[model samples]
Target: MMQEWRRRRQAKRVKPGDGSPLPRFRWWQLLSRSLFTLELVGPDGRPSSYAVDVRQAGDKDDGEVRARLYVDGALRMVSRVPARFPVPGGEIEVVVGGFGMKRCHLVAADGSERQLVPHPRSAEGRRARFDRDHPVASRGVGALSLLAVLVGLCLALPALAETISEIPPVAQAVGTFKSPLNLPGWLLVTVGVAAVVGSIERALRLRSSWIDDLAS
Candidate 1:
């Protein structure tokens, strides 16, 4: 019921596109842009093409991220993140995180959903190809990223608790708490960067958890 309400709200945010030609994905924008495509059969037994394009650089500069939906190489609609664009059979849903895309899938009327295929030149596409071509190496990298995020989460807990315990009322109840792993600033920065990269790697695979969603 709650999910339905959110979907309805997101669907309402969709706005008609200006029918501009779908822009080509460039090599230089590999890191900051993402594109995913989908094809569905219409009621008349005809096939239609759809694409979702995200410009993360603009999103980072401002707080709002916009997704463009293209049909048959022409712009059809656009919306901010958590968008739901009505398509032929179902809805194209898009959600994004700070580092990259978190969810972009076709949600059917019966509740089944399937991810959109990333464009050949997009970062997500490259990552998917890597996984297909090098399964063992891909799993190893994924495990490392998971470990990095886990370690970062462990380090953060005590610091967060210490912060919470420092509040006047809380401190009176539990006493002042101090974080145990008080390393140098530089090492902390390194861990922070690792955590961010780990999160981005996870985002590329469309794998997300509560922590990444909140942090990003």
Candidate 2:
């Protein structure tokens, strides 16, 4: 019984078309808000024709779709459809079967077909290469973020402590020195200068590092 079922399924899978097959290409999806063409290649190892189907997801319109066949990047024959079709960008997908010679071409409404070419050296590939080459900056940013989290935890540690008994003497002394705005002017000025100088130094160091990086 199982053999009979398997034989029946295999028999049903046969297509009754001509045995001579053309190269097949189909639009699997359209994700970006961009228009594309669907080109079909003939059996003779060249781009033969294109369907004038606009690949908008939910557009409503009708027009003729035409594209010229090309050989060695030269125009050969023009094929046309009778009705105008609106392809909605971002929501619709147009499917074309059998598009493979050297490339696939999608015919636009303006009677022009755009060929799809494969690029091995794409932007994503370049980005991966860059990450592989100069990983220090990325790693440094991650390390700095982790260090910031650690510093935040260290600052919070005193708050988490059970009692003032565990607090440091310097913190206790600063708390006890209650002043009615009686802090020394010279001491305040000195502290302010130190803060400014420290901040400027850090900024200058970072700027120098960035400039050196760019120059490298």
Candidate 3:
């Protein structure tokens, strides 16, 4: 299938990493950097720590974004984003979303998976802490973000339809279509911006859906 072909193609893009120590996550780089860690049992029955680090600013090579895998603080492998690195028990999967990390998890041989823990100073870490500290408030904020995205989508779909209907080919085929809701430019811009922010908020919690997150 096409999905399997794409996966194989992406796997070919992976390259070995330089053996350098992984840098500590800094508070100032919270927005641009992401670090997630997992502990796995080694063959010797000892625990080994692995870390996945991604820098959105990317490297000097044409701003090519990559994910770096570190084992016990030393660089083990590196590849472009949406990487899969072989590990002791299984593999570490790393994927970047529009706003932040979409997936960062350890997958076991038996098909079990576990999300890596975010660095304490990272935005994701802060969001996790907030959820634990203020469960009710966190739920309210999450609901608001979903509502914002929903409203934005409702507004966007009509405009999109109207625009598509105006295209010559489409107009000739089905005639021009009118949008039911028309709003001022400023309000449309505001809703778009709110939707973007809401999507980012959801990204902080590693939440993403093609329709809800990408559509808006």
Number of clashes found in candidate 3: 0
Q: Candidate 3 at residue 181, lDDT? A: 91
Using lDDT, rank the candidates from best to worst: 1, 3, 2
RMSD of each: 2.2, 22.6, 1.8
Instruction: Write down the TM-score of every candidate.
Output: 0.91, 0.17, 0.91
Candidate 1 clash pair list:
none
**Model 3 accuracy (lDDT, Cα):** 0.85
Q: Write the per-residue lDDT of candidate 1 for residues 1-216, one digit (tens) a residue.
A: 998799778888899999999988999989989899999898889998999998886666565779999999999998988788998878888888777888999989898999999998998999999999999999999998887788778778888889899999999987999888879999778877888889899989988666764332
Q: Report the Cα lDDT for residue 164, model 1.
A: 94
Cα miss at 193, model 2 (Å)? 26
Could you give me the TM-score of model 2 versus the true structure?
Answer: 0.17
Model 2: number of backbone collisions: 15
* C-alpha lDDT of candidate 1 relative to the true structure: 0.87
Which has the higher lDDT value, candidate number 2 or candidate number 3? 3
> How high is the CA lDDT of each candidate model?
0.87, 0.32, 0.85
Question: Candidate 3 lDDT, tens digit per residue, 1-216?
Answer: 997787787688678878899998887998998889888889999998899999978877779889999889999888998898888888788888777888898888898999999888988888889999999999999998888888888987887898999999999999998998968899988888888888888888888555455446
Model 3 TM-score relative to the real fold:
0.91
